[model samples]
Target: MQRYFVTPAGLTETEVVLEGDDARHLATVMRAKAGDPFVACDGEGTEYVAEAAEVSPGRVVGRIVQRRASASEMRWRVTVAQSLPKGDKLETVIQKGTEAGAYAFQPFLSRRTVVQYDDRKEAKRVERWRKIAKEAAEQAHRGRVPEVGAVASWKALLAGFAEYDAVWLCYEEEGRAGVGLKPVLRAFGSSLGEGETPNLLLVVGPEGGFAPEEAEQAIAAGAACVGLGRRILRTETAALVALAAIGYESGEMGG
Candidate 1:
């Protein structure tokens, strides 16, 4: 079934209004008609199976059939803090991470980061990233879109350390003794009580990876350094691997 993200106001007591782009997509692109049932999510992370009550150029209405827990969201809320990569790699990270069940993407500029955001175009860039996240969430059947944070300097990101229940620093130079992803997640899982959810923060470096001093600073800030494996992963690959590992640990995917 096609899934779309609608505002809380869009999902009324018994109905959902497929407005603007969603309406057009449903009526013209998907050829949706009245009585066709589909799934949709509201702003509050509630999923509903609804039957189309009306389909037109400007609007497609769906009557709510049932409300249930969102299957797309992971049990733990994870925020991926990635060092800005060159080109449009950050976009790819946000898109894939959203599908992988990340709750937010925080792009930071590291010592090795080469991408310079043009001050005049910063707003537009952020907007495009947000749009990508929303569309990706809809495509992935996510209950809500992952937030794409504005690009920030490494120091700015470190200042928000207290917000996360646990922080994993994906630094490659941590050596053989570097904590493994499995153990890191296992520790987190053990800490949480049954039915408890914790917000996790993951830090991934850019194309050039983090400098020793940067890794030091993160470790000093209480972020646990966790290595992916013996193999080297590209900047874009690190977040995906981390998300997959988290999913496996959380039982969102098979262990």
Candidate 2:
């Protein structure tokens, strides 16, 4: 069944009203009509099996048939703090990162960051990124839409390190001494007792990677400077890789 993320207000009294772009997509793109079945999620881990009760000019009303907890979301919470990359790469990162089960995304401006965002443009950019995350979450059957936060500077990013249980910075210059991300992950796993939720934050740098001084600063801010193996991955690819690794280590993938 096709899945969509609806606001809690959109879902009420056993019916979900799909309006805005979603309704347009269903009416024109998907050609959905009355009786067609789909899934509507509240973006709070609840999935409702629904059928089209009414289709109109600008809306599609779905009557809920059944409701259940969402299965696509991972038990662990992982946030990716990515340095803003140039062009459409941020879109790709938002999409893939949502599918990989990221809880939130924070775009940071690093010392080596090539792209600069002014206050006005930054708001527009965050809105666009959030839309991407929403669509991606719906498509991937994610229980919740990953949040796209406002752009942060390196200092701001480092200052927020204490909020997460574990923080890993993907650094290119780090050698074999830092190559073992899995061991640290295992140690983190051991530290968690049963029923404890894992909270991980991954920081990926820009195309130019993190500056030496910046990396040192991040390490001092309680982030582990970890290497993602030998080959250098693109900024977008690096975030996805870290998300996947964290998901696997947290048993979202097979244990």
TM-score of each: 0.94, 0.95
lDDT of 2 by residue, 1-255 (tens): 888888877889789989989888887888898999988888888889999999875899999999999888877788889998998898999998898899999998998888866788888888999999999998888988998999998889989999998899998876345575787788898889997987878999999998899888988899998888777889989988877777888898786
TM-score of 2: 0.95
How does residue 76 of candidate 2 score in lDDT? 77
Top of the candidates by TM-score: 2
Q: Write the per-residue lDDT of candidate 1 for residues 1-255, one digit (tens) a residue.
A: 988888877878898888898889888999988899888888458898999999997898999989998866898899999888889888999999999999999988889888876769888989999999999998888988888888888998888988889888997765356557887788788888987888989999988888989888988898888899877899899999999989989989755
